[model samples]
Target: MNVYLAEFIGVAMLIFFGCGVLAGNSLKTSGSYGAGNVAINIAWGCTVAMVIFCLGDISGAHINPAITIMNAVMGTFEWSLVPGYILAQIAGGAFGGVLVYLQFIDHWEKTDDPHAKLTIFATAPAIRNNVANFFSEYIVTFGLAFCILGMGTNVFLEGLQPLATGCLIFLVGTSFGGVTGAALNPARDLGPRLAHFFLPIAGKGTSDFKYAWIPIVAPIMGATTSGLVHNALYKGIVDYRLFAMVGLTVVTFIAIKLASEDNKEAIKNKQALNQIA
Candidate 1:
């Protein structure tokens, strides 16, 4: 299969399953309602794992710009191919988002909450603060990219590593994902956000373009930062586990600090309001 074709197929699967979870959850009377955070996280993680299994050999099954960019940075992929891959991935993701929307169109019209409709198509923060939302996406993507770098470097662990990487994403979503809905992939966010903008949906929130840059910029920054860190630590000796642990820990620490700061800010704001009232 052609690389672009593989990217299309992989990204289609990603958005289908990824947004499918939201449709399942947000649509009233659906079987997945109240299925809660664990389901969404596991579904996304498994979506990545499944896509990689189906298309890894064909196109490295990036289905994500961060992954493609990181691969290019590591010299695993040619720079010229990056744009095509990213375009295909976005197209596929948008296609998948449209499919999910169509599948749940009736439920969407049946509902009236704009936020609920938005959730069906794209991510939104639990609390709407730009700084917190940006940092959340930044940290999640950073951890994800760091893990990808560590796992992708191991020659003997090719097939199994994708599954492990998927689990890392799963954990990121479950533990720290609540703040910003864990949009760790740029294609995953932008493609679907675009779909929501174009698709006929009732009461969908604004596409939030001002905040849209977070997922794209942060993931690339996180991924590149990971690559730099890996190169710095690369001693011509391959120790996959050690590298993974160290890289994951560093990213996780950053994410936790961001989250903690956000919490502190929230508390301070509440206290200030109390004092005034």
Candidate 2:
């Protein structure tokens, strides 16, 4: 099969299993409803690893437009193939979303929360502030790209690289996923979100297009920054410590901002409750 076809299949598998778990965990009446974050982290991590293990040799198992675009920008992958890879990944993601919706059709009617239904297909911020949400995606995606580049340099046993990479995803999701749902890929968000918009699910809410740009744009920016830094550092043309310091700074900033926002929100909630009383 062609590389494009392989990418489609690989990404389909990634989304099918990854978002499948999200659907299972969030949709009412599903056996795995409320299976919790650990389950989600593990399912996504394992899905990625399984896709890579099965299709890496065939298509390099990019399975993510952000990864594809980053590699292309970094000169590691061909520019000519970027469009095909991205398109395939998005289509595959949509395909996966449709499958999950069909699988959980009954649950959609049973569940009252539209956001929960949306979560099964795409991501949203826990606390919605544009700047903070954007930064949340950026920092985590930077970590993702940086770690992926680092993983490539390591001499792990042939097939073990995928497993290691999967673990890195799990680590990032657990550590940095609190604010923004850890969508490190544009296709992962966009394709499924489009599916959510068009799919005939019962009582599903607005697709939340207002906040959609953060995931798509921020991940690309983060991945590009990581690729440039990785390429420079790998060639000894730049200091690795510089990236470490920058990453630390960004994380610190995000933490402070999120904390401040949370406190403000808490005060507002309390004030509203007191007024009601």
TM-scores for all candidates? 0.81, 0.85
Per-residue alpha-carbon lDDT of candidate 1 for residues 1-277, written as tens digits (9 for 90 to 100): 9999999889988999988997898777677877888998899999998998899889988888987887786666899999999999889989998999888877777677787777766777888765667667766776777777776567755578778867987988898878888877788888888999999887776887766777776676667656656666764434564366458656755775687688889999999999999
| lDDT scores in order | 0.80, 0.85
For residues 114-154, could you state the per-residue lDDT of candidate 2 as single tens digits?
99889888899999877788888987898899999988887
Name the 10 consecutive residues with the lowest summed lDDT in model 1.
Answer: 234-243
| Winning candidate number (lDDT) | 2
Clashes within 3 Å, all models in order: 0, 0
Q: Candidate 1, clashing residue pairs?
A: none
Q: Which ranges in model 1 have alpha carbons more than 4 Å from their true place?
A: 153-159, 235-277
Q: Which 10-residue window of candidate 2 scores lowest in summed lDDT?
A: 237-246
What is model 2's C-alpha RMSD?
Answer: 5.3
